[model samples]
Target chain A: MISVSKLLCGLAAAGDGLRYDDPSGPDQITEQRQRKPVVVWNTTKGCNLYCEHCYAGAETEPATGELSTAEGKRLINELAAFGVPVVLFSGGEPLVRDDVTELVGHAADRGIRPVLSTNGTLLTRERARDLRDAGLAYAGVSVDGLPETNDAFRGEEGAFDAAVDGIEACLDAGLKTGLRYTVTERTVDDMPGVIDLLHDVGVDRFCFYHLDYGGRGAAVQDADLTPAARRRVVRRLCDLTREYHADGAEIETLLVGNYADAAFLVEYAREELGATAARRVYEYLRRNGGDPAGERVADIDYRGDVHLTQFWQGYALSNVRDRPFGRIWTDTANPLLSRLRTREDHLSGKCADCCYRDVCRGGSPLRALAVHGDPFAPDPQCYLTDAERQRDVPPADGNGVSEPAD
Target chain B: MADMRERTRVERSSGDGREWETFVRQDPDSSLRHVGSVTAGSEGVAYEQAATLFGDAADIWLCPAEDMCRYAERPLCDRIEDAADA
Candidate 1:
């Protein structure tokens, strides 16, 4: 999660310790505290709508061999024991399962913050109320574009209306709601309108997810944003975020699925806000570690299989069914899982040589694997120029500040 | 308690200038409190605008600005004094 809001607004919400008054000075100041990664639990492999870019390849029917409600509750308990701070209930469509509220309630009871990620088709007013009553902290609803485009992408006729209604229902029910827009070349042009629509409808948070090549997404990998296009899009998003923020709007903007966003933001700040602000941005990026996939992020599908990320399928370090989730998560014995822990030593090619390797961390290893067939290869989505990559990154020399970007 | 902090809330005004009253709560069990208002063209749009305009509250409520009712023309404190005098 590249917090566009934090980077743009300089607000310290979570994980970031930088004070607004006295920002961290140049020498690489590392945040000493390490909290458990937010874990994603796919509550069910059942979905009502068949989205074109469904990462789970979800169909209209439920998948065979999902974890039972009892097993899910046990898994939640194990995750809480593992020190996971937040558990995000994801899909197929999390709302498809009848006992989702019960599962969320159980997780919350265990003191783990529970969040809901859904397609928004089934989130009725009553259901949203029940979820709030059950202790759901936040709910993210996915929307690709306006009614026609969104409905088309969802592969349903009434999906757009239902989802918009769902957003209203969640708000009416008092459920803190957000919008997730998966950015594709097709939908990129619609971003401006999407932003306006979200503001008009009163959705506070908007996440722009760069296309990750996985499952159905692989079919349209060629349609992914070009480096130049991505830069333009990022600039637009940054401008909009700043505009809204300056006006005192509570709306937050975030970019996901791309670590390059951090580097981009750093460059943007240096160009616009000057050296001191840029240095603060760098500190925040370094503290957060641009990409947290293998190190901090972990996901479990409905079938109990664990992967580095929700988009990463086919590779499973272990399953919760075979052993407890805590054990599986900490067990670095698996070759891939072990390699992911110390990726710096194993990052191949340009990624290893890049000066900003610490910030990019070879970009998304999953994207690298998807396009290059090697998990350690440089991320195909890396948008930095050769000049930018080759620039000597000055070490944090005490409280020293580096020269401003030319 | 009423928020007395010096803060500037960015309001999303629908071009039409009509607005809706908005309310929010910290959690399910908490009572709803009026956060602010959102300018929107219609009630549906008002709900959306209100939802986005409010800060990180757990729940939100929106109704047309015109629909709200009032008990008296003066302040509650002033009303209590008048009733005692009467």
Candidate 2:
């Protein structure tokens, strides 16, 4: 995830230190994050709504052999033991499970900060209060677009209203809540409306997710914005974020699922905001260590499979049911997992030669897999041009002038 | 709690008699639309029911009813039953 607010606007988002190793961020969180990754546990595969781009291909009933309450608690124990700093309780919809609060409390008790990712239609006032009381740190509610568009995308007529209700419930119950929007050709136009509507409703954070090709999402791969369109959307998001900050709105905006935003931000800064800003953005992206799939982020599916990422459920390192998650993650003996950890060494084609490879690590390997049938292939979604991907000669001094060759 | 490494495998049952909400696409060009739902013991049964019910459709999708939690005003099960009645 790229914090547009932090990079362009110089805002210190709550987890900036831990996420980007920003010196201005909290030292304690950064120290803990260095030791362990953030885990997204797909608590169940059951969901009320069938979103067009659902990565999990979520259904209404929990998948056969979903981790039981006891099993979930054990997983929490394993994560706590592994020193995982955060556990995002995600699912078809986490609220579907009766034991969600208990699980959250268990994670909190074990020193793991438990957060949530849900559709938000079910987050009633009582449910939000229960979750807060159980120690949920944050709740990210997915709201793809405006009522009509979001309803069309989510396969529910009143989903938008219900989700808004859910968000208000979370805010009323004193839980930190945010909006999660997946950018697609169909939904991109509704972004301004979503932001304005949710912002008016008191939501301070908005996470815009790039559509990744996985699960049902693969069916709509064509719906992903064109390269030029994507760049325009991102630039608009940056401008909107700046506007919010300028207005003292204190709104936090983040872009997720695409690390190209890292390099794009630097370039955007250089061309628009100037050299010093570009340098600062570059330094932060460097600290972030590029696409964090196999390193900073880990996914445990409903059943016990550990994926390099939530979107890359196509591959699994091992099952936590058979081995401890810590042991599985650290094994690295799995060739795919090993390669993903050091993708800089394995990246092929345009990605291998791209100047910003260090900052993007070839973008999302899952997208590459979807397009090229090879995880090491160049990310088809990398919108950077040939000139932009070239490494430039370093400037001799602090000024933007390049030094002559020796 | 048992140590992760030392824990014994527990017997688990398959999702049987579960309600699966069905979706259908009229043709290749159309998006999947929510149809009615069917009660089945497994994915195979669910698929069979969906294909039989929405036979003319080009594609079919099913999600479990238990997974969808919604507000009391419009429960997913209630909607499914209404669709079934329709």
Candidate 3:
């Protein structure tokens, strides 16, 4: 996930752009970017609402072999011991689990920053307080669109009300709260309304997700936005983010499941805000290391199977119940794992030649593999123009001197 | 688990060398605690970096590291270090 608000407003306001690492002051050690991956634990496959494009293919009933509370706690210990930075509790609805609060407390007590990702139907006022008391750092509630649309998407009549209320509950309970919105062609027209709703609800952050073809999402892959439509929405998000930042609204904006947005943001800035501004944006994006799925992000399903990313359903790296997460993550003997660590050499098609490949890393491997059989194939969703994809000529530097292509 | 605040303390040198300190409050009524710091060239970037790095907070405030003031004798790390050094 790239924080559009953070990348643009954070650096743009500071008048500084290139630093990538955590700042070390006098007497502080320069922090090395650790290989520790942010782990998302899918607590259960049980969900109350069934959305059309549910990525987890969640059912109303819990899946078999879902981690026991004891198993879940043990995994938290293993992750903590492994130096995992964040453990996001995700599920068909994480709140559906009875031990979720206990698990959140366990993670926080172990110094793992605990976050919750849920459909929000189950997050009641008291439940929100319970979670906060359990030391959850943040709660991300999925709100797909307006009341009617969101309800239809969630496949429940009052899901929108329940979700919006859940967001309110989290906020009222003093927990840091944000909205997670997945955009499809159907809901694309409602993007601006969604932003307005975010403001109205006083959400602290908004994560706009590009559709990923996983689980039930595969069924709706045709509903995924066109490259042009995706670009239009991104441009709108950038404009809205800048407007909100300029007005000093306290909100964070981000795009998930896609890194092309980052590249497009830089390109957009170059055309609208001039070269200096574009360079600043480019430097921030570069530092963020776009599309850090298999490398920096990983997922442990309810059954303790570790996958390359949360969206990837198959190809388990190792089961946390069988081995420590740290060991499994560091074991590069798995050919795919090894390739993911340094995939630059393996990226094919326009991705291998595009100047912005470093910024996008061939976009989502899961998406690529879904559209084409090859995980390393060029991302079909890349919105860059033919000229941009060709890499025949170097992008013009402000000074007009072209450096040799790598 | 290692202290994330301590773990996240490393700095970057690629762009602007300026650094900012991040403070977060878990609740509207809670006092702010020093969460972590981010290295950015500008104040706007610092604030955004602080938010991204510490998004769990209900409220976040960022100031250039150079602008922050502290009592050298009354450091929280000293207490933490005493246990470590003991």
Candidate 4:
């Protein structure tokens, strides 16, 4: 996840230090998070609503062989032992599982911060309270667009209302909650309205996810925004984030699933904010160590299979049931996992030649694989033009000024 | 007695019987009640069974049958009676 607000606007969010590696970052929590990868655990595969872009291909019926409560607790113990900072309890919809709070509590008890990613339709007042009491740090409720658009995307007519109620429930229960919006061509127009509606409802954080081709997401690949459209949307989000901050709202806006945003932010800053601001953004992006996947992020599916990232579920390194998660993660016997660790060395085509390769890290390998059938192929989703990408840019100096290239 | 013991051993190892017992509560105010049992090769399978059968339940708990220790001298008892009495 790229913190557009932090990189471009210099906003200091609670977790900004984790991504930007800010030297004077406020707390020990940020330092702790910097050392560990955030783990996304798909607790269950059962969901009430079948979303159009469901990455897990979630269904109403539970998939066979979901990790039991005992297994889940054990997994949490292993993650904590491995020094994982955060565990995002996600799923087709996490609330569909009866042990949602129990798992969240287990993660917390083991000293790992627990967060939730859910459709929110099932997040009733009681449920929200239970999750908060169980030590849930935050809950990101998916809201694709405004009522009709979101309802259509979710494949349920009343889902929009239910989800809003769910968000309200989380807010009333005193649980820190935010909106998770997947940016797609079909729903881009509603972004502003959704933000306005939810912001009024007390949600201050908005995560805009680029559509990654995976699971049901692959089916709607065509619905992904065009390069131009994506640029416009990202610019709008950056503008909105700055506007919100200027108004003293401190709204946190993040872009997820695309490293292109890193380069885009730098360019945007240079063109709009000035060269010094651009250099600062570039330095922050470099510190972020781009395209986290096999480095700073991991996913453990319902059956305990660990993947490089949540969206790269097509491949699995090892199962927690078969071996400890940390052991599996460190094994690196799997060539793909090993290669992903230093992916810049193996990046191909435009990604290899691009001046921003150090910052963008070839964008999303999963998207490249889905589109080009090559993990190392240049990211088809990189919106930066040939001239922009090929520019002989200088590295940022210690003083946030660009040093001449050798 | 020997036959019963042998049968129990076979059942535990065969992986065909309902080795996992599941419980569920309808809501926070409700008491957890034993819903059913499922045959599973691993903890993940057992969870899927419980979740699928009681997806709408407010809470669900699963336990391996072998992990359960009865207080009485029941057929499934695996612990010493004195341990419970103490």
Candidate 5:
């Protein structure tokens, strides 16, 4: 239940859009973005495959990014200097960095756990073992569907098999392995099969994403994700999670689709866990879940990582003197997130007057800006976008009891 | 024994080809057999205690010695392998 204080805060938020967009609004942007953050360090811009659906298509290679061992050390030193507890290192392929093992060791020395996201094509048993030895905590592999389906999307013949092998290798090595499945128009048809594959591969958990219409797939928007498809996908994923829980596997169900379910889950989880813990889970999802650009830190592809916006640029943050990757909570000054965050969100046309405002946050700043050209604007697909009372959702059962729903 | 806090019964024929019906409760790691005998490992439950109730499936094969041990020793919940098969 919302406290009168928070309710008042909600009222305050209603005025924030007005204040923030005002020419006379105080210079609060920097203050808003100055909070402590989890940062990504791009180690390499080199990759091996050329996936058609990849947002980082042309940028996943060494030429796009480069940082010598010394340069890599400098970035780590800077994060440590700022007392940053976690640093995500990504690249064209972090595993390609010759000093990745060393970088992992350095991160371990600094008491930072390195987690990563990769296609898993280069994640051989030996490499996984080596990375584990080097103190890489976990690695997420990208596998869309079963072999026939997955291999096609990955644009590699043996990618599915390699990913399977990578998961087994990581499990055997006693390292955590997660599967990343990007949803696209082609992949939505096989949601059940995709869920089954997540089990068959025996991954510890899986992260789901509907096809992001950016970079490589941007031009293919018609063939990309449909809002209806995303809802269907999240519903199935929610059920799959229920089954996994019944079977006794630890499952964290995530919806990287239209923000509808994600928004609801956040409110529900918050009511169930209360405030502080809920905030942590939300931040954890943003940082540990896939970054918009999928920029990995030193762990996944140790070579060099790129920003979510720089994926197709094919370059490295290490190549430059200062790291260029965006911070999750500290992007107010960031041109991309700033431009996206300022405008009226697509859902704002509806969310501004609704109780679900805090939960949905006017839908994703990234996605709404992608479609409607304004992050602060109301989401076009939002049921509330049309001002229908039928579209508003109850906050939750204020008793803080969550009846499990599959 | 299944270590589950709750469970739904699912009956299937075992490779041993025994037409025995069993209800087991299990957790993520283990299960407790509450019916027809499958594996006969000594799970430390007493036997003769249920001898009177063994009248129907008492073909020794239907009610293995260990099954009695489990039923006899374990109350409602216990941690033992295949205790549910009991």
Candidate 6:
């Protein structure tokens, strides 16, 4: 049901996109569905931080750049005009640009809600207040996991505290805030600890994103979670959800994985969830990774070109300035972001048969095509022998636990 | 929340008009059309001149007839196939 709603909004936005597969019907009529009120606009092509699994694109070195204030403002203005009620700000670090507040403030003034996606190390109380005063509504801090796990994935010391501080600052400013972790082979083990940290910081609503590789991480994808590794992570996440829930805490976990178990888990996830819970679930799937091409997390090659949300060194977006990836959204020929809309894997190569294909967003078509030479191929780990599976603690599912509702 | 389409926005250019003259990428594969100014004639002649120019480009099969005028004005005109025969 959660997946269906997301598909509805996405498909409705496609405007008659469903007709592509329904050959027997009229050629150009789109069924009316709920429209997606928000869109993520990647303003900066470069990032300042270079974590092990970074996806910001072109973080090969300590480079710092952003979409010029001029064009950035243009984007915000256009988004407001397009009637996209919400715009998300992301980058190597959106704060790195001196003019980020300018765009965020502008969007907010125009009655367009603005959300900031940041690694969270650079945010200070003063900065947070400024953001709030400028009308920033929410902030998403990426803290991955606890110290040991987080440092490895974030590739920076003290990022843990920086992220916490960033969240605290936003909270201080009365902005609704949240945290997210890209569950991977390395950090999935620390799911329980990560949840505890979220509670400590007063975040009742948090999102967990399964690790995926598209642009930058494609360079180092083998380090990506194998299926066996992913199962281990999922089981633990499941247990943690149970542990927290049994204790009478209200905890919600948005699972983002290969969807290897998604078909079965969808009903399980909604056993007794609400609208907020449902929305949390939808966002988990919406923002998670996988490229248009099958590029693994470790297969990222920054020097190469890949279509990114923004024009990064790699990750191309066809025509960044004029078209919104017409090829990817050109009716229904695309199998990447618009996959959920068409309900078929037009470009997933051979992945359509896998039950998880529908759930995992086919991971990333570019990544799969890059690492496995077939976007439709099951994640390389899925086909391995059972003997290859691990006999350790399962991954955290976040549903087993519940934090006391604040 | 209000509907997403209530706001209106205009894309802004960063530089002078000369910037476009220097930056407009002539996609080598674009269709050619004729939109350039046509010669002024009698009272009803203005629209007729423009219409005639439009007709010249419209006769082409695959080429973008609207673009024919731009190329025709440049030194590249010699290279443009008028399709007058085709």
Provide the TM-score of chain B versus the true chain B for each model in turn. 0.56, 0.60, 0.59, 0.59, 0.18, 0.22
> What does DockQ give for each predicted structure?
0.01, 0.05, 0.01, 0.02, 0.00, 0.02
lDDT of 5 by residue, B1-86 (tens): 96655432211212111222233333334444343232212322213212221322323223432222222122112212323221
- Taking the tens digit of each residue's C-alpha lDDT, what string does model 3 give over A187-306? 878878887876788786888899988778879989899999998889888888889888878477878889888788777666666565566667766656667777778898887767
- Estimate, for each residue in B1-86, the C-alpha lDDT of model 3 and write its tens digit: 86444221212122114656566786798888654345567778766645543444688787665565433332212222224211
What are the Cα lDDT values of the candidates?
0.72, 0.77, 0.73, 0.76, 0.47, 0.47
lDDT of 2 by residue, A79-169 (tens): 8878898888998898899999999998998888888999999999999999999988889999999999999999999999999999999
Model 6 lDDT tens row, A323-377: 3222222323222323334434443444554433434555433344455654445
Superposed by TM-score, candidate 5 places the C-alpha of residue A225 at a distance from the truth, in angstroms, of: 2.6
Q: Score residue A129 of candidate 3 by CA lDDT.
A: 95
User: Which portions of model 4 miss their true places by more than 4 Å?
Assistant: A11-32, A392-406, B1-86
Error of 2 at A393 (Å): 7.3
- The better-scoring model by lDDT among 4 and 6 is 4
List chain A TM-scores, every candidate, in order: 0.92, 0.93, 0.92, 0.93, 0.71, 0.68
Residue-level lDDT tens digits of model 1 in B1-86 = 99554432222212123546666785778788654354456778766544433334578777764465533232112222223222
Show model 5 residue runs off by greater than 4 Å: A1-35, A59-61, A266-348, A379-406, B1-86
Report the lDDT of model 1 for residue B43.
Answer: 77
Best by lDDT: 2
Winner on TM-score (1 vs 3): 3
Question: Over the stretch A1-406, how does candidate 4's per-residue lDDT look in tens digits?
Answer: 7777677666234544335543221111363575677888988888999898988878888877787776677677768878998898999788889988988897888788888999899988999999999999888999999999999999999998999999999999998888899999999999999999999999988889999987789899999999999999999999998888888887778898888898888787777665656766787777777788887888888876677788876555645655577877787544456677878898889888889998889988888877776777877788998877876554332343443322
For model 5, how does the per-residue alpha-carbon lDDT over A353-384 read when each residue is reduced to its tens digit?
65545344555443544576554565544432
The C-alpha stretches of model 3 lying farther than 4 A from their native spots are A15-34, A390-406, B1-86
**What would the DockQ be for model 4?**
0.02
- Weakest ten-residue segment in model 6 chain B by summed lDDT: B15-24
TM-scores for candidates 1 onward, in order: 0.77, 0.79, 0.77, 0.78, 0.60, 0.59
Query: Would you list the clashing residue pairs of candidate 4?
Result: none
